[model samples]
Target: MSKRHISLKDLANELKVSISTVSRALKNHPDISPELTLKIQKLAADWNYTPNPLAMGLLRQQTKMIGVIVPDIVTHFYASIISGIEEVAKQHGYYIVIASSNESLQKEIESVENLLKSRVEGFIVCLSQETNKYDHFEKLNSNEIPLVFFDRICESLDVPSVVVDGVEATKKITRHFYENGCKRIAYISGPEHLNISKNRKVGYLEGLKECGLKFDPQFLVTCNLSTKDATRATRQLLTNKILPDAIFGLNDTIAFAAMKEIKNQGLKIPDDIALVGFTDEFHSTVVEPSLTSVTHPTFKMGQEAANLFFKCIRNGKGFSEKIELKADLIIRESTLK
Candidate 1:
């Protein structure tokens, strides 16, 4: 081989600076001092370094790449949404760079910064469960970056977003439980800080009131949306003096954990304890006493987010919109009794 190709990363490593800094120096951005810019330029010339053709194209016109960030990438929930986003993006002559926060706030921030360095034209994000502070997102807005949020979003930010009607979905679940003669219904919720938890709780309370049932504090419990924490929450309700006749969880993971715990305690689903869950995950049908759940329009939600992101790019800063999609309850054996 004559010589190995030198990429921006390699140049950054040699210069002991960030990739973004090196990139700015190469572009002769005003932010980079003249002395440092000259040094970087001379180094690149001596090394015969050339930028990626695609990156050069992006500098000439647009990156044609959209950054997508989600709490987790392995879930069916996210996979479908990403498919939809890609479908819409490809139709518009754009591609996507996906990043997983893995449900960590710090990782979410890192993903944003890294994507920015890549110079993606826009971003579509779903908030991680641990994202209580929204400064990272706010920074994106302050810089006039085209940003859109889906599913779990930060309401404090004025960015465009797409979400399922969690309040209405939970209300439907509560109504189903009440219609099935479940008086003392319980809800296992996620963290209080999450928008999903707050909206669902509101619906649960409103549904109880609509059905002429008292909102019993004992029947409500919060978990961190982990299997272990969900199991603990379920156990807490089960051991109560007056056990709830029906139970629903924030998502299928929580519902699955609750189902296992309920079985371990010798409770019959829908007979002694009706069960329902959100997200309508794949295993919802395969599980014994097949779970009833809310099926979100996930693909549509993603398409809408991507569509909204393009709109934001065209509209520039101070443009905001919120799209709330509907979800339907899938009746199954778990709540039929």
Candidate 2:
């Protein structure tokens, strides 16, 4: 007869260590010394051992895994969010399976399907740029699986969501610029399909109206958050007869590009024109004068999404609970005026 597959417990006994210790060593838990972990890992490999992903999935009907899909993994905001989710998952004795949408609806759908096929317990995602259709989300909902939308969420899906108050956050930042002796403030926002972008655009106009500043269509520029688009948008602003006194961006990446171009054009930050950005994130503080942006609670948002997912997973009828987190404005060198 064929010998039975060796288990972690069997390895632990052979190594004269407790099962818990072996498990921790295998996972490379911080408490385990690196030398000991290396020894344990060698033993497991010598045994031709394999981590039973399918058996684990069967145990939880869940793969003991959660899927996290984001618009782009390169952004600091999303990276922070994933870190938080990983922490929360670890606390719950679960692991994360992350994927990047790269702003493609097809990719998002394919990723979701793959995770589902693997029996991931739940999903947390930020929709892609081309995800205007609600059918994919509807399909997720219909599967009797848990789906939590975070950050760039859909407006149509009545599912649980985590996002900052875009309209109010933009209003606060734009109003601050208006009060600081800056009129003709330009708005550099993201793709128009994004709900957050639309909300912030509306708030920018509202801020101008609130400060008795007339809204100018010429001051509004939408870009794809790329270097080329950002450069072209900045050039468009320079070509205009009416120069903006300040500019507010939808996110830090676009803001950084625009800031670079503005400086190259002999413009000074908070001097020639003040600037504000959303997502007070990485490189914001490292930049020359630093960037003043709406500090989004990405980590907390991720935790909330995980918590909501667990609730749904445990409670059959409570999956529809919606959550909205508010954005905070972080004062820095860029908007000190």
Candidate 3:
């Protein structure tokens, strides 16, 4: 049978000392005699001994592990953000525990509980689309856990957050549409409760006013950010008495759905109706008539969120700040007209 790795107890027994003494000696604690420290160090080296991270963490009450939550992990958007977060985490000798809410509030709550049980030192989160309540997060805030949010976040909470200026991005898209000679511009928004939808709607209205165009309630519609809902919204807009000459979807998923629905109705893109989307996904380039979209600084947003989390850890309780990043409108074939 293969030999088992020796434990601290074995080392203590062999050296005729207590386990605590062996541990302190290995650490070269000043309280340990120089001779005993050398002996313990040599024995540890010869035995190929290593301290257990989990055990040490329990002893010191420092996990050095951060919990991270996002809407979903399949998209390049969240993946890129995770990469950036990991980069920062490694620099600080910390690890991240990731969880996906999958756009469900219940799942988000469960994830929070599970990560807390894991004893993660802190959390970095992007609220799910369906997360309308803040009670689950409020508990962490009340307990003074190191927490930072990114992208979709709770603005009411006194927690640090990193996000893009959706308002300005949408405004840019609207102005681009107007400059392209589209008068009846429409915007497809997400749920009313989402901060993203609210911010973009503000920008859309501002853009319309800036272009000297009156706001038409019929031109704006809401979707659940799903393909079917987006397609239905698109159909509703198309069937209006005065059809929109341009359309902007809250995200690529919505835009792709709108594209299909528009094609189904025999409408020519950038001819009968121009289109744009937010979150420039990779598929945007490969799709026929490449979609115009808002390119967010996802990686940077991740880095900022991680940095903010560490800052909160250092500053201790009741610390909060907000960081806003900028996004650019990538004009493409779909909006060229």
Best by TM-score: 1
Q: Rate the local accuracy (lDDT) of all candidates.
A: 0.90, 0.81, 0.89
* Candidate 3 per-residue C-alpha lDDT over 1-337 given as tens digits, one digit per residue, 9 for 90 to 100: 1134457887898889999999998877999999999998888777655454223334247778999999999888899999999999999999999999999999999998788778788789999999999977875676567889998899889899998999899889999999999999999999899889999999999999999999999999999988899999999999999999999999999999999999999999989999998999999998888999999998998899999988997888778989999999888999886
In model 1, the Cα lDDT at residue 111 comes to 91
RMSD of each: 8.4, 12.6, 12.8
Task: For candidate 1, write residues 84-176 as lDDT tens digits.
Answer: 999999999999999999989999988987887887877899999999998767756755668899999898998899999999999999999
Candidate 1: which pairs clash?
none
Give the total clashing residue pairs for model 1: 0
Measured on C-alpha atoms, candidate 2 has an lDDT of: 0.81
Pick by lDDT: which candidate is best? 1
* Model 1 C-alpha RMSD to native: 8.4
Question: After TM-score superposition, what is the CA distance of residue 60 in candidate 1 from its true location, in Å?
Answer: 8.8
Worst 10-residue lDDT window, candidate 3: 50-59
Residue pairs of candidate 3 with colliding backbone atoms: none
In terms of TM-score, how similar is model 3 to the real structure? Answer: 0.82
Question: Please, what are the lDDT tens digits per residue for candidate 2 over residues 83-167?
Answer: 8888888888889999898888899988876776666877888888778886656655654467788888887777788878888
Which residue ranges in model 1 land beyond 4 Å of their true spot?
1-61
- After superposing candidate 3 on the true structure, give the runs of residues whose Cα lies further than 4 Å from its correct spot: 1-60
Is 1 or 2 the stronger prediction by TM-score? 1
